[model samples]
Target chain A: MGQEMSKIEEAKNLTQNQILEELEEQLRVEEIEEQPDTIKTEEMVINFGPQHPSAHGVFRALFHVNGEIVTKIEPMIGYLHRCFEKIAENRTYAQFVPFTDRMDYVSSMHNNWAYVLTVEKLAGIQVPERAEYIRVIVGELQRIASHLLFLSTAGLEAGAVTPLQYYFDERERILNLFEKVCGARLTYNYMKIGGVRADLPDGWLEETLSFVNRLKKTIVDYDRLLLGNYIFKKRMKGAGKISAETALAQGLTGPPLRSTGVAYDVRKSDPYSVYPRMDFEMVVRFQGDNYDRVVIRSEEIKQSLRIIEQAIEQIPDGPILAPGLPKDIRPPVGEAFGHIESSRGDLGYFIVSDGSLKPYRLKIQGPSFANLQGFPAMAEGSYFADVVLTLGTLDPVFGEVDR
Target chain B: MLTSGQLLEFANTNGIPIWVLDASIALLLSLAVFAICGLGVIVLVYMERKVAADFQLRWGPMHVGWRGTLQLIADAIKLISKEDIFPKNADPWIFRLAPTVMFLAAFVGLMVIPIGPKLVVQDLNIGLIYALAIPSIGVAGIIMAGFGSYNKYAMLGSMRSAAQMVSYEVPRALSIIGVVMIAGSAKLSAIVNAQSVWYVFLQPIGFVVFLVASLAEINRVPFDLPETESELVNGYHTEYSGMRFMFFLFAEYIAMMAASALTVVLFLGGWHGPGPAYLAPLWFLIKVFAVIYVMMWVRWTLPRFRIDQVMDLGWKVLLPLALLNILITGIIMLL
Candidate 1:
């Protein structure tokens, strides 16, 4: 019985090795078979996305994976091809604000303002002083909200869900204010061609004051939860270090550009909408890394809060919307590109009016779309984990990228 | 001879009723602590949410109880009612046993915690040591769940957690040595009593080391490598579901509570009186919450570390520093 058991054990060992050898041979044969097809093709082709989770959206990065490295990334878009620009061409200026919501849904207000600001410039309409101030406040608040969402989701991709919940909770408060102001929460069509849709509510000032005051403690909490964390530092620091030269070449702006040590904020550089009087500094970071991106967001939130506080203090007692304008808005035949510092980057809207109520053409220069262009360039030699971190720091809004 | 028989008969009759009553009370109080653990787990989760919300510049649970106080109630309801699922290929007993093992570990750790003066469930002389030993048992549960799942990611996560816990254990234990040497006792009450000025000011280095190590051991933030979403997904508990999943979650929060309580006992002076005896536990809880808040901040602010870096920091930096802290404490004590 003992001799038979020993023989059976030996046979089992032999069978295990045989199975291992067979599996190895199968893998080698599969590799051998798969390589020739790609090698024979003079044009080496690889599809990087569409189905890939890290493409930021339905955007595809068709590329050649040389070993573990990405050789090239060809961005294949139109998966979310609603042709928002074309849709805007047929709609009146007032009607187009809703469509603007589709472009960068994270910061829909920025898009709305950009479109309206362009039309307001073409029509040569002067917005009320209080309305302009309120617009700045709302726009700045939305920018903070959008950036916080970016921070949260980016952190989520890095396996940090607590911060995501924290940020969304804060974002919900801003959304509540939006709902109170415009009667719409996520997609607020508050901005009209000439001015805002409605006047500020009765307790709007008091509510805004309380929100501003409470903002600091929450910021401290976020700091405790994330900023001061060692792991967060390890993951973020030196992870995606882009230089100012590369960023400039890529036409990067807003947080990404600022992260590369540039101090160019649209509010400071161009001073559109009553930003000239606003007391806010351009938040900049020097490392040009993921850490810098996070710091830039943090600093920007502070500046945004500052702007909101100032707006509340200086808001003149006047009509919320500019009066004495034609109900059916029309601007003369002209074209203008209005740019705003959206949460992701610089959001631009080029409007071509044909002296009609509707535009002849509307071209949206989505910052997230442009910002996503450089992802493959950055992701070449990095690990898969870094790819997630890098993509997070870029803060891509699929709505903007796809639109 | 008649008098001796009468005395023996009288003593036996009285002793039985007193012993029975004491036994019943002890059992009832143990039951109460067990009940409190259930409530404590729910509150800890809600508190984390509220704290996180406050940090992000928002109100957390306004829709639930007064300011969303009842949010945990809703969450508990959701978790309890959810379907408990086990994979077809999983080891049936281990899969069922893993969460229970984790829960049991947490519950045992709570036995050593002295919430207030004489309010302990068990005032064992080895209470502090018992608290320290219980968390390591959860590692086994993690490994069991990982192995039983038949998922590569879960297995990898389990391996990662084992390494992380082992590495973190050194600094965590060594940091405690400073307080241990100063108190001259392993008893938690003695440790708290020794800290009249609070160990925070005296052994600030030890405090910092303990905080970092505890955070790592609890698997928060930069140390949360085992379950990194971009890497290992949901870590060791990937296949867990329903009440089992909740059990794992409860264990994590309980671990958090345990770590916080340890911090209070060692550095912040646990249940020491700034107020009346009844209010002292509240103060202890507040200190623990503060530590938890700091943990949250560290999580949000910092990025995660690679496994190698985590181990290197633990073995090379924290271990040596913690040892030095203990040595210096010893020298100071001798003088």
Candidate 2:
């Protein structure tokens, strides 16, 4: 039994990159021996994106293909860059909240919360209990909305059109809820430095509770519609596999890291907002392949619903915004970092204050940027179709990736 | 009721020259086939959109002529009016010829189908083999489009289509063999006449194998790797435009009709429903549309399989099942 345990441990310790290297070496030696000069094949380098469908946005990659198999991948980014950080330097701390919304525009609420959390930490502002609870509720709702987009796009990349339409119905409802709360759907600048922009409107809590309850039932239908499908599972099962160490080393967070069984969520490891008070399991899967990465997001949506339900029940009646704050408030000369578990991954904002109204230097550590680093590694030596599937599973929003 | 032989005899009675009569009859038959297939393509396109919309939870093409009935006509006009573009480095002759070859290949397959009693263009003795063999010619057109386009995505799409079509032809042919053995003829009309009980009942496994392999053969979803929109953009026809692009679209829907019609003849007892002889074509069309509807339903509901997985299913699973189906049919015949 001890010998078997050690053997299992050794197998688990084998890095994915090492295995890929060994396989490539074997393939290389075989190809060198078998090839004849008369029938030699040349590798074709094809540009996969920048204007392609299923790119999610204006993301580009060069794929070197031998027949249908991809031998190498080179990712090109920054086409959607809008000089967000540079613009942040010119604006006041309060004025910068709206700028963060455009970073990861799909889940703008989470971006809003992450930026505000950094500012709150830097300015030493205290948020009321009710505001934290409201933040948690909206943040969890944004997570669900973001994940719904991911699932729909993933379905589309796999060539299933019905799931995209079906999942969008649910995402539209979530967006409607956001539109009601913040008066803007796509870029909700609802979070302030110390609290939320406003309290729940009449019957808002009941409506949110109803939405979660309805989603909990429909998500099962979604699982049956897309996730439980035979062809979908076959497409995803062993494709684009990465090991736990490789995932962590690539700085992957959220579902991508959790898929490798790392169990490292920013909300759980370092508690934020009302997350510590909420009872929910950190969703994890062990395969770390495209399938697990997708499945983990569905599981996380369930957990997010759990968190929202708990927050709504525990919310206290208090102030929405902090009292006695200056209109153009300045922070002391110091640096502060705040991270949140956004829909895609760990979204963090780092601020360097110089006792001025505007930030001296502001940096956004976007999870999409970091998660995309692992894509080429996973995509190498995969089939051309699997490369697209792997990119869909990674779910990098280009707004964040090129921010 | 007007067979080609009756028309030729009528021309002979009128003292018309045989050669001129033959030429005119050939022209007339070609025009009739073209007209029927053209009308069929428009209806199939509209039906495909409506069916896809129904599955996708939206109103599809509602503004066009009463729930998108005239949408395809509008599309046809648009396609006809568009500029025909040839890429700078494209091989003009091959690029120009590809869509025609593809359209003709699919078009000719419909000539052999027995829509009603004595209604076929030419009920040749080798009709079954001809229908199967002719559509494979479309692969050549696909390869030509890919090679002549000077585009990498088109090249990849064409290569994938060639590989997929070639691989699927085996199981498709094998699956049909069980029905051919029981029917005792390769002529499509004879085969349909042999089905007192539909072949789908006795050859259930063969029916399934034929359905799946034919789906792959026609390049429907779940097996649509050649023109995977997300992965390959527009695939082989990426650079095709104007009437040339319309040819590819027309060929696809016609090919879909041909496949579904062939499925009806082989399995569902074509033109054999309880009805008058005048209504036989209607019954045949109803069966054809039913099968086409199922194909569209599957297309919307399922995601595509990766190329390797598709090849695996074709070779490892369906091939063996098809062979076993033949084996079982032969054993029962011996008993």
Candidate 3:
């Protein structure tokens, strides 16, 4: 039996150089056979990004521009890839929760929550009601922060500066609130396997409620300053319009999908945590254009504020962590998928545990990676400026996409 | 009066020969114009940053001098010392010559504006028209710079510049006809004097068309498609750096100053406020700064338009409104 198992392993094993050589040979054959330079006479291939000001991250796009219009665009990713999936295979289940923090650093609470949610599902562990409520509060706040960032940077890409600064001020307040709660502003590794790291300190919830009340009124300032301005409307409306069919076909979710008049929010469709107990509406816009994308996000900030308020009131006094779980986190052989409505879109974490301390395999389906599939279509016939507008509206966080 | 003729006469009486006195007066006026152009830009740069900070809620340039008043001067020194680059196969002569044209276009346009009753420079016969024509020279330099840069972004930017400048010039030139008709001459000083109630009240429609077209003429935001930051990078000046870049910047601010001055002269009644006759130019300066402030306000508030949208605003909206103003002015004159 030992000899047979060794023979099977040896048959499957391939040297690193052998694998690289195979890829090199395929690339060489495809490069010649495909005639990559056939249309060099009429079209100009512009290499955009990876290092561009508004590519948002290290996402490169190869565009064939005819005059100011983009005739074709092929997005080339992987410049920021560090293989978060492969890293999960080596790290223990409980130890790898912090890795999700760096995956989408913009809203680290969502990343933290998603990984823990999956682990709890896979191990059949239960989280207390107080922990769920805390998760909901921080998750909603993180969504607000992420959307505010999206709106501000989108405004900047269209050549407006004041709105960006004004929005950053609001985000600073949220960051301060997060700091007071967890002693960490960004990439808060506060979520654990079955509960939160700690309970809320004194007066933090009241401060949060006051901030939400203030933001509810102040959010209109963005519209008065940027969205309602005629020039902004002209520049962004109908600039990179995507139909609902095209967006759904590309497996788009989050604001990009919601902007197309779909009400498919993960928090609603597949209710999780304390979300089902909360009272808030999912924001949606009819037109799937650049304008709708921004409008949806700006309106969604109000909804997040609503959710945060409800979570503060309904949170029950109970144990923060569940009991009767091994510290080592060795789950019996099983697979499970956990998803949450992340800021960018539907973020799902899949893990396969083979009755070991570490996971056998892990996969993350990031919304940004899926949302980026719709980019070439949006940018195909638009003006050069509209390309940046479209990318800004999609709000792809490269941290999640390349992870 | 401090007119050029009086200055020459004063020089002649002060023991200078007639020929020498005439040349001296001309040289002094030229020197004064250059000085105002240079110094005014420094102040404008500082004011714009300070004002932009106020609008955006940020502290802008608080380190160099008191309130960073000398920030631009330090910047000037930095720019002068940096390596002046030229792209491979770029036309050296045109690349070197382009900024001079951009600078002189605004500089020479300053010759005809009457800053005060007696502080007129050349006071040409067709002063308003000459001012209109002079800045068109910047178009040529822009195109040359774009062609000479050997970069595709520069080429597209210059192409957009050529199209935008040519299209906007029609409505801009046409709008001035209403003011000329009211003043009964194309002379800018005569236009200023004709406005008993600051023609903005009499010809409000003309003033509106003029403000819109003039904003487009100077490439202000919403009309700044040629230099659309998100689109074409830096537009026509994408490849420039060091002092050559500074010259382009200088040209932009000077054009702004000259345009705002012309707006004051045409509609605000140049130097006509209640004040000492010699100190009246201060009123002109105030009104011009007011117009510049409004321009900055519009710049900060509005996002940039696409090239097609800019072209549409020029041809479809501004041109017809300009012609309508002229038609109404003619009817009023006939009645």
Candidate 4:
């Protein structure tokens, strides 16, 4: 065992005893399960999802299960691949904003901001005061919408059917607010190269303030329905405990990483776009388990509400777009990476401009893709039902994962 | 209240021919049961959907009929009319026989279920035992479907049902024994009559054990690990479609009705409510629906348990609890 630990240490380049302890614990579990039973049961190879009800969307997980515990995990993804990066290279710099909307469709506002924030940074276009505030309001509202969905799906995948309805009801109202703002429900191409497509509609800020007040109550409703539910809590707590080291090593961002006691939110740590002005707390938990992740999302929803409240009050009136910004957005021949603390994680976009109308190459630093690297690690020894909850807690939108 | 036998006697005394009378009695009982099953399914399915919608904060099926009253009928027509697909490499005999076994188990259990004192199809002395044993027959059908389908998911689901059913049967039956002991008969009608103070008060622990165990036996969540739709994608009945799957669905709902009916008899005073003597059947159905409501509420509210955790719950917690209930009953009886 000591020799095996040393070999692993040599391979992994780790000096700490934590890895060895985790390995030892895994071995103990294996030994316990392998202890001879009256009727021996062989391991079954099971293909879960791509079409699975609880798989968020289009995630295929091939697992070898001993009764219910997942022994081997081979996660088969790319079922929702739309080739966003490839599309980015083909289209003009400003034309690809719609494509970004589809990447994380639940939080399309954030996706648009991530992409445009990069383009704005790359081309050195100054977003007007009103545009930044609108961006914050829209982005934070989208975050609330995204987290609301996360809460619903997490509860649903864990077998509670009621929370999804409540969450969706709340989400629909947010979407209504979104529609009022942009005249689009899902994929809003509302963000342009330098600024928002338009200013908030008449009384939009007042309406948004009212929405924040309403959302405070709805958020509590979600907490009551799901957070305090015994079966939900029992199913979530200690189900998918991922360590902070593995999370960081996998380049994880967002709630999946933050749940492991690391408050590495790009918005806070690496402040971007109007986030410095919006004062709010970053939610974090120590366990990095399913419960912690769920709690983190719930807490973040509250913080987002706070930010929205502040944004609405502090938002200034000015031009919704940068003045003197050319319509034909062609950045200089240079590479620039722009990232923001999106609802999911540090949603980043990297673009290489060739001094042409279109970008030469574009790379999407999607959080879902990065966070999904920790899935096989988390699901390795957990129960089959626990695997569903783990996937829910991880909350990988196939739009982002397979983009 | 004319029993089936008395109705036969009346037919014989009347100018009706012997063959016609015999056929009529049999046909009447069969038709009556079929009507109950069909109508029960329609009402219960609608109730379940509405209840689930209410729980989830959405309006259930509301387009087909007034509030989608005809939704189940449409579903039935579709299911019945749909193609009966036999999976390639399926063991055709067992696959075909599976739904029948499940359907008949549920249907036959209805024979012993007493809606009123004389409303039972065949109130055999061993009605309670018969009710218990009949449901176990469905387990074989579950295993057969799992085995015969040759689909890994179906097999996993069936195997889960096998393990779950076997483990839960002990507690399920044990909990019922307290009721049977109090009644001094396995006859379900007698058991109902025996409840003067309503055995639920005397055997609260027994009622809890019975409810929990029966939920496991019927594959309700958090005991529904076998047919976990999220993990197993419809469980043992995954490969089934059209009418065959409908049979499986019918069996599930019928079994739920049976469990509820049995609970009403054993715990709540059966068919004894605040109404006229003739309203007993209505009261009976109302109680059954109430029980079904709770089960469905639990189904939508609670998450599924891990397989091992479910086993631990059944054996370590439920089994011992059931046994303790029996011990307490015995002690109280002696005192």
Best by TM-score: 2
iRMSD, all candidates: 4.6, 0.7, 1.4, 1.5
Clashes of 1: 25
In candidate 1, residue A184 scores what lDDT?
86
> Candidate 2 docking: what grade?
medium
Candidate with maximal DockQ: 2
Model 3 - which docking category? acceptable
- What stretches of model 2 exceed 4 Å from their correct place? A1-40, B1-15
Give me the candidate number with maximum lDDT: 2
- Cα deviation in Å at residue B115, candidate 2? 0.7
Error of 1 at A73 (Å): 9.7
Q: How does candidate 2 score on lDDT?
A: 0.92
Q: State the lDDT of candidate 3 residue by residue for A1-403, as single tens digits.
A: 9999987777666555677889999999978887756645677777777777777878788878888789899899988898889999999988888899999989899998999999999999899999999899889989999999998888888888778888999999999988887889898899999999898888888999999999998998777788898888998899899989999999999999999988889999999997888888988888899999999998889889889989999988988889776788988899999999999889999999999999999999999989999998787899888998998898888889999
Q: Model 4: which docking level applies?
A: medium
Q: What's the interface RMS deviation of candidate 3?
A: 1.4
- What DockQ do the predictions score, one after another? 0.30, 0.78, 0.45, 0.55
Q: Per-residue lDDT for A1-403 in model 1, tens only?
A: 9999999999999999999999999999988888755765443344535655445666565555442234555667778878887888788888888888877788888988988898888888998888898889889889889878877776776666668777887888898888899988878888987788888899987797788778767887786677766666776788777888888888877788888888887778887989999877888889888888887888788888898988998998988777899887888889888888888878888888899988999888888877776676665556446656787788877778778
User: In candidate 2, which residue pairs get closer than 3 Å at backbone N, Cα or C atoms, i.e. clash?
Assistant: none
